[model samples]
Target: MAYQSLRLEYLQIPPVSRAYTTACVLTTAAVQLELITPFQLYFNPELIFKHFQIWRLITNFLFFGPVGFNFLFNMIFLYRYCRMLEEGSFRGRTADFVFMFLFGGFLMTLFGLFVSLVFLGQAFTIMLVYVWSRRNPYVRMNFFGLLNFQAPFLPWVLMGFSLLLGNSIIVDLLGIAVGHIYFFLEDVFPNQPGGIRILKTPSILRTIFDTPDDDPNYNPLPEERPGGFAWGEGQRLGG
Candidate 1:
């Protein structure tokens, strides 16, 4: 019999996964272009904007290279959050999350350049994503097979490290502001007639994007989180 997809729940996506993936790829491609030198990449739109490359925006996610702990943390965080989001948002609305992430990162990067704190672009990225993650604090992950931990520690810890490294905090603060405004406008009045139904109620804003109620049938393990990636078992044990 012809069947309709279950509409019992929707999927979600953590904001950082796309941008962090984008940053790593950009760094790798920069090196490939013989632009590996320390000073070459700074304020280099050629790499960030992909030399006016029309396809750069999409390619950025695949352009990453290892940048020490940042890359490792990203891999782990992405697995956990992406799965959680997918499980939470069931009607395949993960695309909306990605849109917010990319646009938010772009806004932060723009502000970073305007204020001359170009170096802390990544810091701003985490801030933009973390604010949303906090709203859904019930989310948790196993800490490297050690302990079950939550509270969105990765983003906040990274921010602290950035501060200790003498990086600019204003950029991150400003990025959060930009994300807040973006979230508001995206929901309350979207273009498509049915778009509002898929809209997220972010916790940061008092009214909209609040912690959306968990679906009664929402089983983070089977039906949602790992179904696409087949992460059913991995997700259950807390990856």
Candidate 2:
């Protein structure tokens, strides 16, 4: 019964988040089973363009590394925040959410061409975290019970922690940069004086992802539920 309930709960996750997290997990499992190698997954522009190994472009962002602490840490953050963004602010806006994914992935891939970074999954996770943090600025967040701050600082705090972990800060920085650009254009600039909305969601997206609303005034209040769910309230350090 317990396992059945868990399976059902897992199925309730938003489609995009569920698919992404599953891919990451399965990718890691495949690596652990020696079915595929890390070399095949890492981003390599030369190989992608010249050798027609185009799978690397998408695969790069799917695998973090072997199954261990870093993989677990990143997967937790990815599942939590990705689910929140999809179910919270992006509720009923699947197409727009997907566009954000495409936008971020494209920018990161372009940036990856210059840098020697391999797996971009961490950066992609950070980008999602950054966007969620900005959207929920008033929400208080506690990290590892050692530090506390408003939501917007979460990505930077994670970057600092990454520095402590001896991991490269470049990927985190890249994610932050891309995330900020998207936020500024999508959310900030359009509301500013003399600013026009440039990042319009396509009509096809609306037709596909949007539901006809009967209550136009309906606004989703920030969830005040307990943590260990999706809202990040009372969330702990590890998964």
Q: Which candidate leads the pack in lDDT? A: 2
The count of residue-pair clashes in candidate 1 stands at: 13
Over 4 Å off, model 2: 211-239
- Full-model lDDT, candidate 2: 0.85
Q: What overall lDDT, based on C-alpha atoms, would model 1 receive against the true structure?
A: 0.47
Error of 1 at 116 (Å): 2.2
Give one digit per residue, the lDDT tens place, for model 1 in 25-89: 56755675667633443443456565654343333333323455555554444444454544454
The per-prediction tally of clashing pairs is 13, 0
Model 2 lDDT per residue over 50-120, tens place: 99999998999999888888888898899888888987888878889988998999999999989989999
Question: Candidate 1, residue 173: CA error in Å?
Answer: 2.8
Tell me the spans in candidate 1 whose CA falls farther than 4 Å from its real position: 1-66, 78-83, 119-121, 124-128, 139-157, 183-239
RMSD of each: 10.9, 4.5
